[model samples]
Target chain A: MRCAKRNTILLLALLLTFAAWTSAQDEAPYYQSADFNVPIIAGWQNQSANEAAQFHKPAASATIRAAMATGADAEAAAAADLASWLGLAELTAPVYRGKVNLADGTWHVLARDIDAQRSVSQVARQAGDRFIVISFLESDPSSRIVMLAIAQADETLETAEPEMDSALEQLTGLRLDNLTAAQARALPGGEWLVYQSETALVAGSLFGNDSYIALQEGTAGDLAALADAWRGTLLGFFITPDNSPYLWLGITVSLLILAALAGSFAWRARALQKDLAMIEQLEKADAR
Target chain B: MTQHEAENPLAVRPQPRLLRALTIVSALGFAGTLVLGLFVAGTDIQQGQVQRIFYIHMPSFFGAFTAFGATVLGGIIYLWRGSEAWDRIALAGVEVGLAFALINLLTGSIWARPIWNTWWTWDPRLTSAAVMCLTYAAYLMLRAGIENPQRRRSLMSVYGIFAFISVLLTLFIIRIVPDTIHPVIVGASPQNAQGAFEATSGVVVALLPSLLLWLTLMPITLMWHRYRLALRQEAVDALKLKLLGA
Candidate 1:
């Protein structure tokens, strides 16, 4: 009977764990608007958010680093600044002669033949100084670097391109307002945001030799919520429970040790009780 | 089997004096390892000061490997001879081995970040190690969920023997597989590894004994304590049965 009871409990525990794992897997990929709303592409997981929100996709398996600028001319200013950096460094790499303008009117700076099989691209824009820079390089599979391997192993830049575009579009659409350092720091995603000053909200993600940055500006409430939602969307994928098994193992072991000690003490007490009762009974008989 | 015997169980099994001495020695040895690893070891030629993490990383891994191996040996003895002592050893080995395994994984991650530039990757070596850690944790959980003593011991013995496969896989996966980015310092890797290095004489001096002494002392100390605890629990169970029978 005891064995049967124990087995049932064990079975129930296994089922409950399975159920929880399933539910975490099934959670919607969309981040509902509490402070702000963002829908992360499926297969991504959020790692951190502050100055920049780091989103990693397990399938395309690339990390997207985002920062924001809510200043007056965010997109155009960011683009010109990046263009200047690219111009200076362009001569060192195998360069393509002309710039390719995207359908969204943003220009792309592509560095051709960086290695035998890889290229680097940076896209940036500014209206006044509300600028965001999204940069990535084609990861070569034969690269010795692990980060490059992860970026290039099976993840094609083509698959990640759409996700990047969507992120840029959402970021570009926001209206940013200036916040004091204290105000910015007080926000929910304050610590994770890229720049925590009164001017620009910039976040940067650096992987291997490449970096991706996003800038946004707006009300402190909206800025915090947006950063947090993007973080949630990117890091939403479930691989395992956050709680470590070692934690449960430690608890179980400690309890078992305590129970073992207590059981021995209890048994010794029972034996003493039995001996006292026997002595009293013998003494009563002797008196008679 | 009498009331006197029941009242005085520890009299039959005197506490081992060696346990205390071993505990003290192991504590002092560990302190020495920390001091030597931190202050005595020279900066690595390739990895700089961060390479110091290798001292604890290597020893803890070897310690975990040895503990798991001991668990296998204990399991085999229990299955063949059916001695409760052997079963106790198996239980003790897994618990102690598991602690070391965690240290190995944590320290490995700390080492990987600056060198590999990533906290974790699903390379064969790392993946296999993670699986090994999970398997042993399941072993403990399996023991905990069972109520029947004989069945618990029998099943754990078999599982303990089987679980060593993952440990072997963790150790050898990088050697066998060509695609892994994990560094193989002692032997050849088909692919270039960013963090592979030659261990200097200073590293060898600190590493070899740390591995041997920790593998010898840490598990022995933990196993001794667990063995005694198991014995006491067994005595209590026997007393309960005697009381009912009387």
Candidate 2:
């Protein structure tokens, strides 16, 4: 009993020591988010009405002739002249012109004319890929404008490929161009292309812009998937040339270790408790 | 007689003169360390005055860990050797660990506000410490839940061992992995590098004495109270047995 009493006193002393240690630490204040702002161009508008009106006017016959004077193909000249008259800064729009080939069930054109006084009329055909163009007398130059806007789809699909390619190369260290035919075949359907140029028109009346020619085509699910695939491949390249197995193995091993440790500690504790109980029972019986 | 004396088989032992003397010395040590910790320690070049909190924070962590360690060792002895003395030690250590853990957490938050620029971070050390405190608190509750003294002690001893293992893991786990959330404790700032102490003789004079005093006094105070508690528990057990016999 005396020994037990001494042990009890020693135990109490240890506790008080711990308490004193805890109380010694200082309490400080907490900090929160600092106030700041990052400026991003949310929207823009063309303030010049004259430039907006010029954008609205149809391409003139004289402008088309002058554009074609360099002996450019008629379709190319038409697109160039229209682009130049519209002051289209982006050089990416492809020029395509074909007349309706009534004889062969295809569109064929012969001797099309566009000049300074002519307006370009554009009609999207019912068939997804077909478009019709009719040249007419130019409307008032001051009021005429080619209203072009960049749509969300144009942003996602048109500009995505080049960004995806660069991101993929950074992530995977594999040049997109270097992928072998077999490797390319193995990838989910979609071919990557770099954006050369793009142009849109801002008219006087419209609040948003409009794209004249947005060039991009791929059959992958969506822009996000393309981004993910690029990121994964890049990360995978760093881990291993072939990384699927390593990722799976790493996850599996960590979970297994955690589970084993938890289970063993629990089991041992329970076993110790059982033995202690048995010892106590035996002592009680002996005392009785 | 004090109210506790009514239920205690062994009345509160009169405060021993030697113990009281030691306590006074210990109190002096605690105060000295605190003053030194606050004023004399060189300001962290990067963290400035906030870094002073480290003195308290680190010691509290050490104290809590030590207490928990004692609990585990005591628990193992209680189970293997069936020493009630070990059980008493284990109980005292757990209580002490709980108190220190609380201090560590509170002080850590105070320090965190200025340095990490947030009151709380999901940093591994902080999270693990919190978990450890909760686990030990659970151990205390488990002990309280049981009516049988032997069962409570046995169960708590096992819990104490498990809690110690968790504490070890908590301290070491973050080091082996990447954790962006918690700022690295060591080499945290290049300007205020490790052991940023610029102690004059006066500061050291005050600090060393305070540390020694607190270290010595804490155990004395706690042990004194624990002795009283053990006596009460013994008396209560005896009374129960006597009543049963009657």
Candidate 3:
């Protein structure tokens, strides 16, 4: 009777412990909507009238760099200014051959005629200047040119010029002054047209756009560098995806633990059976 | 001889001390399992809090299977060696297995309610587990209907061995074929595409202890209960002999 009472007390204690453990295992919420975002730009589009026949091909490419360069303070500021205008908190300014700014939420830039024989579209726009360039690249060739009106800045061009130059230098290796654009009559296939701010420029292409040659003109080393920077940014966001990885690990471990427990019980049953057999044999011997 | 004397030929058998010790240990182990289980957090990447139910559901199923396995093994031994001890152990194991299986089914349904968006599913694993539970239940009912102890033990032992084979088929069939209905968790598959696994150090710390306790406690408790049952049978036999003229 004493042994039975002790067993009962132990059973009660075990039950209490189990209840406490289960309550502690209660789950907590880990996913939130703010953890992920759908990227807006699926891919880039190049619009060049000379390559009208093969406009569907890849037209241009631009090198994307971090805004944290040693001399990129000026470029970073200008990128920040543009980003602010667009209501984007996180923005990385890419170096384009032309001066670009947010014009009523749309990117607008003006290119001046660098060569006397070349048209205004052939030359990249310089920093801190205003000029007339109303051609907008539409994916549909049949669509009419939508002339975008440039809005006058509240500040003078002289004050914004230095800031824009610094921002461009900081973001892209080439200073805003060195940026230039050129028009080629070949199909848009191989040329890399980079749209950094709002302004798009034709850099160079491998095959004409008609042939669908997607090669962009750049040293392999430079492409690798740009890819590295993009990868770094992506890594930061991977840790905090809407479905966090930590939670998955927890569930897996729990399953393994349960399996182990089952195995242990099976082992114990075997041991107990041996003991029971011995006791039964002893009882039978006493009866004999 | 009286009916009681005829029933149990050995009524004065002494209970073993080892059995009592196991009972104490098992009770303590069970307590520890419950405490640890409650404290561990059940967070999952995709299912959120609903995933915590996995811990309880899985262990219960595992415990039930373990008990069932013991029952079959005990039944085999009882038939081969013709030992009453094996018969008693088989009976106890089956009873405990049934209890745990019932708990497993209930907890699994509770878990499925929030995650699978339903209270019950006819998924292969769930169906098989249910069938296995019902079959054993039938085994118990059949035993109760019989009055002859020797016949009842022999039939139950045979049925227990057969039921174990059914359990094996139930557990392995879904693994052999693609189960389109119920999603697989933990293993690599499309079911894992939704990202429903995660384990942190804190969760491991809490769950491991609980599992250890359950593993230690289950067998000890079951064996103790079986011994007590045997003792009660002996007591009934002796009392009947005292009342009847031999």
Task: Please report the candidate that would top lDDT against the real structure.
Answer: 1
**In model 2, what is the error at residue B235, expressed in angstroms?**
2.2
**TM-scores, in order shown?**
0.47, 0.42, 0.47
Looking at model 3 chain B, report the run of 10 residues with the lowest lDDT sum: B188-197
**What's the true lDDT of residue B120 in model 2?**
79
* Candidate 3 stretches greater than 4 Å from native: A1-288, B1-21, B40-42, B180-207, B241-246
lDDT tens string, model 2, A1-288?
A: 999999999985775465445434422111111111111111211121221111111222111111111113434444444555556554443222333222112321222113333234221111122222111112333222121112223343443334334433433344434432311112232332222211211111111121122112121122222222222221111100122232233224423432453354346445543543454455467579
lDDT (Cα, tens digit) per residue for candidate 3, span A174-254 = 444454542333221222322122231112222111111011122222222222222222221111222223223434444
lDDT of 1 by residue, B187-209 (tens): 68556666776654566556655
Residue B10 shift from truth in candidate 1, angstroms: 4.6
Instruction: Give the alpha-carbon lDDT of every model.
Output: 0.55, 0.44, 0.46
**What is the Å distance of residue B35 in model 1 from its true position?**
1.0
For all the models shown, what interface RMSD does each have?
Answer: 17.7, 18.0, 12.6
CAPRI-wise, candidate 2 is incorrect
